[model samples]
Structure formats: C-alpha cells, structure tokens
Target: MTIKSLGNPYDGDVDLRHGLACNCSDCADDAGHRMKAVSARDQRTRMSTDDMLDRAVESAIVRSMFGHNELSRRSFAKMLGGTTLAAALASVLPIDKVKAAILDEIGTPEKTDLSVGFVPITCATPIIMAEPLGFYQRYGLNVEVVKTAGWAVARDKSLNGEYDASHMLTPMPLAITLGAGSTATPFLMPAVENINGQAIVLHNDHRDKHEDVSTWRGLTFGVPFEYSMHNFLLRYYVAEAGLDPDRDIQIRVVPPPEMVANLRAGNIDGFLSPDPFNQRAVWEEIGFIHILTKDIWEGHPCCAFACSQAFAETYPNTYGNLLKAIIDATQYASDSANRSEIAEAIAPTNYLNQPVPVIEQVLTGRFADGLGNVRDEPNRIDFDPFPWHSMGVWILTQMKRWGYIEGDIDYAAVAEQVYLAADCGKVMADLGLEVPAETYKSHVIMGKTFDPAEPEAYVESFAIRRT
Candidate 1:
C-alpha cells in the first residue's frame, strides 16, 4: 500500500527519478498533475500483454523495492505477494496520481581504523589476500585480517566494534537489518562481500555408487544450515528436481567443510560448500557434483562487507576508505593471475583449509562434473561501482517467505538504510568507479526461471505449491 493510504506516511512528493523525496502530501498533489500525461491511453494499442508487463514492471519489479518501515522486509514483502509496482504505486498516488519512490540514503561519518577481521571461508578470501597483497594499504589502509569461525561470530566481532569490518554473506547484512541472528544490535546494508563461489556437495550415502545420479527423485540430501543462502538455493534445487524438499527427500544439516567427509563415509548425501572445500569434494572424488550452487543461482550473490548502522554513520571516511580498499581488492581478484594467488593462499590453513589446486579449480569458475560435464563462465563475481540496492531488497523477500518475520512493513525504506549508497558514492567518485544504470546480476534458480522484469510474477508462476 502507498503511504497516503497509510494516513499520508509522508507529506511532500517523493520523486524517485528526480532524486527528490517529499514525504508530504502537497508534493503528491503536484505529482498527480505531472503524471497525467503518461497514461495507458497514450500507450500504443498494438503493444502485447508481455510488452506491457515488461514496460510496467521493468527490472525494478524483480528488484527488492523497499522504503523505511516498522515491518521487517521479510514480513512486508511476503504480504505484498504478487503485488506489482503499478498496484503499489496506486495505493500512494494521492488523488489518482502515478509517482515513483526511490529510497533515500542514510548519512555517513568520517575516517576510521583500517584494521578488519576475516574468517576462514571462501568468501573471505579477497579480504585476506588483499591485506598481504597490499591492496588495502595501497588504498591508504594499514589492513589487518583476523581469523575466526562461523558467520555469526565473524558478524558479531564486526558489529561489536572489535573489528572495523569483515567479509560476510549478502543475506547476513539483511538479516542484521531485520534483527535476525543472535544479536540485539542491527547491521547496516552491505556493499556485497562476494558473488558465485559456492557449490553443493552430496554424500555418497544417499546414492551409494555415484551412478549418473544427476536428477533428484527418491534420493535424499542434506541442507546443512537453515536460512543461509546455500540452504535456500538447496531448497530451490530440490523443488526443481520435482521432489518436495520437505517430503520427497531427506534434508538435514552439516557444515560446509564436513560435507566432503560425510559424503565419503556414507552418512549423508551431497552438501554445500563455498570454494576450496567444494573444489575438495571434486578432487577427492567423494561425490559427484549434482548441482553447483552458483549454477542454481547462476550470477547469484554470496558474501558482503558489512557493519552496524551506527558504525557507518559515526565513521564515514573510515567506512568509505574500507570500501575503497575492498573494491580495489575486487579488481585485483577479478584479474585472472591474482585469482590463482588468492586460491593458493586461501587453500592453506587460513581460509578454505584445503589444497590450493582445489581452491584454484573452483575459484577460477571452471568445473568438471566428475562425469564429463564442465562449465566455465565469466563475470560470476563482481565489484562494480553500481548503486544497486536490489540485493538488500531481494534478501528481505526471502526472509519473509519462510516466516522469519511477521508484520506489515515498508520494504523500500528498510532497504534504503542498508544499501549505504551515498557513502558508497563518495568513495566511488574518489576512486573513479562508475555506477551502473541499473545493476542486475544474472539468476538461475532450480526449476524457476528468474525474471528480473517480473520476478514476483515468475516466482508466482511456479506449478509447485508455495510453503
């Protein structure tokens, strides 16, 4: 619903394209007059329904469009199931006006300490390698990398002010916004940690003999962790296999590293892992790659660098510099030669805790399906200077889908706070990175064809039942 329907949530007119937001009603009155020129009657009568839908929804439809709200993104987005931008705008177009609402950015602070923490995960590799490679220091930071276990612990240290920043999940930062996880303190929106370095490894126990067990049917598999990106991807994959994740297959929890061991012994089927370990699963020949997590989501998101909302506001320069260093590291990692160095470094005791070759095989984005299947894709991981707040919005929808939150909320508002676009912009301008027209990452979810233009519709089109 629009703000006016909710008692004029704000007064002025909030023009997204104009980059000026007036929460007051007077602006809404003004906007009503302006939008009158662009109507359905003016549209070409010959336009097909698909074109209309595309023009109406556009890519923003699939993006996580949100604003400030009392309701958590998870709850708010779920309530708007099948809610179109047109319908959402209808609720706010005071006196029958069509308007756009682009979320506003939160304030930022000055400089901060350069020291940051790291955990032994594939996603954290860039953070670690960048330190020793002089990426952070070159960007004016005396970079420090701390080692830890588990995402929660890493996030806590980053939030508690123990470390300036850390490598984390794309959803982890969003969960922080919703006050999910084991913390009363909330995390601000992330600058995206990593993209597409994850894989799902199944245990041999389910299939026993790794025979061309390509499809999911009677065979059962383990999910490892719930609410984590891997778990969601796993569910999407199983459902696409024509098997009910909750019924058709046995789903259980196992650590990313433990997946390979369990698969070898016959305790559970394949599980999910990020980098070196996923590469380990293949090298060890423990189990066949049933479905790569990156393949399921394709150009999907993985990790992010995040901090508490308070931290970003108090130390803007520090935050900006930190982001600058990471962006530099991202450019370094994107370079093919530096990637090999990253794989070799993380494959050791500090990161993935596996062999360099294993890490290299997976991080390089080329994989063999043990049974003569191979895939090599470029642009899987990105570090562009785009002001895309879509990641923050999409994650909120995922959280709401599984009943993690319950209430009506303002998605655009909440998402705006997390993106830290203005802060990112200050640094992007200084660093010379150009923001994208509309940031969009390719997505391939199991049986679901991700339609960025009408994501809600595509997701609703599923023949399978919704949970």
Candidate 2:
C-alpha cells in the first residue's frame, strides 16, 4: 500500500461540547497526554506496519471533522478516550465501509514510474536521496531522480512536461504561476527540500576585501538563477552594504555545478550558490566561505519540490504518493544523525557528483572556511517540507522590490494558491509530523522584520529597491 494510506493516528475531531476556554484539571491533564503522544509519534523515523489501513480510516475521519486544527482535536481526545471516540465516530459514520473503499484505492498508482528532475546540489538532497534510500519505493513509486544541469533547464523541462516534477527554487513556482519568466502556467510547491543550504563565497584573491563590501565595487558574482534565493539574498546583502546591486556590481547566471569551475577560472569574483558548490570551492582552495546564507536569514527557504497544477490534477494518486515520498525523505534528512549517511547516498556521480567529504562538511556544518578556520554550525542547512505561505509572500515582496514583477498584486492570495501549505500540512500530519497552526507569519531577515500582512509597506521600507 502507498504511504499516504497510513494516515495520522494522533489527529481527530474535537468534542464541541467543551469550549476552548475550559481550564479544568481533567482537561488540562488530558491535553498534556495528547501533546506527549504527538511528540512521541513524531520521534519515530518511519511509519508503523501494524493497523495501517485502520489508522488511515481514523485519520481521514478526524481530519474531515477537525481540518488542520490540532488543538481542537486534542481537546476532544482529552474529553473522551480514543476507544470511546472511535466507537462514537463509528456509530455515526460507516467506518468499516469507508476503510474498505480506501483500501481498494490505496495501492493503485495512476502512474507507477516517473521522472523527477533535480539540479546536482546539496539543496536537492531529499529529492536525490529519496531514490537511493528507497523512499519512493516505500510510497509505491518508481522514481528516477534525473540530474539536470541548471534551474532554467529544469524549469523548461517542467513547463514542457519533460519532468513529472522538478526540484525548484522557492521563487520559481510563484514566478511560473505569474508568468514572470515564462508563459502563465499554474504551479504548486507543496514541499521545500532544503533551507539555508547556500553560502556566499569569495575568490581567495579577494580575501582582503571580504570584510569591506564598499571596496569591491566592480566585482562579478554568480547566482544559480535570476529567480532564486541566491540572487535575491545576494542583491539584499550587497544592497544592505550600500552597494547598488544593479549598477555597482555585476550579477551573472551560472549553474551550480559550474560555479566552482567559474570561480577557479576567475570568471566571477564570487558567488552566493548552493552547496556543496560553496564547500567545493573551499575544497579546491580557490575561494573562502565569506558567510553562510543561514547567517543572512535564518530558516529561509531555498529549494522546493514543485509540479505543474495539471500534473497533480491529472494523476491525483501518483501525485499524493510522490509528495509523501519527498516529505518522508525530507523528514529523515532533517536529523543530524542521518547527515553522513545521506551525504554518502547523494554524493555519487549520478546525483550531486561531489566528494563525500565536501558533502559531509556541508551537511554536518563542520568545515574549513578556506581562511584557516574550521567552524561548527549545525543549522547551516536543514530540510523542512512545509512550504510556508509567508515564505511565498516574502519571495513575492522581493520580486516586486527588484522589478521582476509589477502591477497590483494580492500577495496573500497568490501565496495561498501557489505554496500549497494546506496540502503539505495534510501530508505532514499523515506522517505524524507537527504542522504549524498558521500558514503566514512574520520573518526576521538580517535583523529586519518582514510582516506578511504589510508586504507593500515592507517593500516601501527597503531603501534599495526598484519599486
């Protein structure tokens, strides 16, 4: 059976008889146990084999009643024990009949084999590792994680349906949906593969100018794509240093794999590219790590698993299983304990095509900075599958600020439509992972607060913006 069939056991509808304001000791105690159950369930790295179909039925019933509100479900569970609740729910709904119907639909994949594209970088770790680590297999998918040369190629292939789904930059889906760089095509980003896995590297020759951005006015830098966090972050970083990113410095589009070679050839002074490219630069002794992107904006999203809306609608079952596989691998990759194994799994030529040591340094966050210092910062890169609506709003704000998009835009509506946070929350909940209560929230980037509620005001506050 597909992994999606094994729904979240800890989630269900809450009893409406009791209000949320209730602070009774019995309710409080039950709430505490509910929280603990969720915590323990999240700790398990894999799904349980026992009672899988039954759990799916229960989960579907609970989710249908409660939606994404876990607190209500917890309160309901606290008020009534699981057995009583199940019996009550069964009395009203045809639980066994529903379970049988779901069972009949579970294993039948609309498309068993598929092509998923990814750029060869650590940012695509979850997508690449899912193939070798058997996550796709676990979800009844035969996936080929094809390694593409760059983001543009990946985008083109995805647009033409050459790729069933592709590892995309966080902004790519929004851009595609809005027809920023291509024809207007509805795209959906259900999950983010990596966050903060990018770094700004400077050529060894410019080591002295690293501390002073003002002195390096004529230097050229490379970003993976125009619609990328690397480009946005680079522009933001330099603009913060009082340099006009458009006029003072040159920004070029170089693919991730070619970044090290370009740096070695002096084709560019530096780049804010994805690892292990940054780590590869350090390994080659041609560049030094100036700063990790995490330092620029902690927990900022980087790469994501995105597909055209048509693909999802056409092959609903395949799409569901595909999302589960990606999210499952992503959660597994989130643990630091699995970094080395994942690094090894994805480092071979067919995937990232980098040395294991370099990949390990990027994954483990313990590496030489090429400036004669080894640093340890474990959150340098992380895997989180939830594609936050706030993140999409922030990307939209950046797009507006830099003139990539124009005219009146409904930031919240676009974000909600494209990011697919609701779908991600459902999948995450099914996997017994914690889901955020809200899709949009404020973010602090380089000590600057970005309120999603006032995106236009935030854009206006930027001193160095195109709009």
Please provide, for model 2 over 1-467, each residue's C-alpha lDDT reduced to its tens digit, 9 standing for 90 to 100. 11322323343432221222223343355554334433345335444433433543456456456642345665776588767777777789887787666546455568766789999999998888776555665555656677799999999999999899999999999999999999999999999999999999999999899799887799999999999999999999999999989999999999988999999999999999999899889998999999999999999999999999999999998899899889988998999998887886676666776788999999999999999999999999999999989999999999999999999999999999999998899999988999999998888999988989999998999899898
The CA lDDT of each predicted structure is: 0.53, 0.82
For each of the candidates, the C-alpha root-mean-square deviation to the true structure, in angstroms, is 22.2, 13.6
User: What TM-score quantifies how close candidate 1 is to the native fold?
Assistant: 0.66
**TM-score, each model?**
0.66, 0.79
- Model 1 gets an lDDT of 0.53
User: Which numbered prediction scores highest in TM-score against the true structure?
Assistant: 2
For all candidates, what are the clash counts? 39, 0
Model 1 stretches with alpha carbons more than 4 Å out: 1-115, 204-225, 372-387, 439-467
Tell me which residue pairs clash in candidate 2.
none
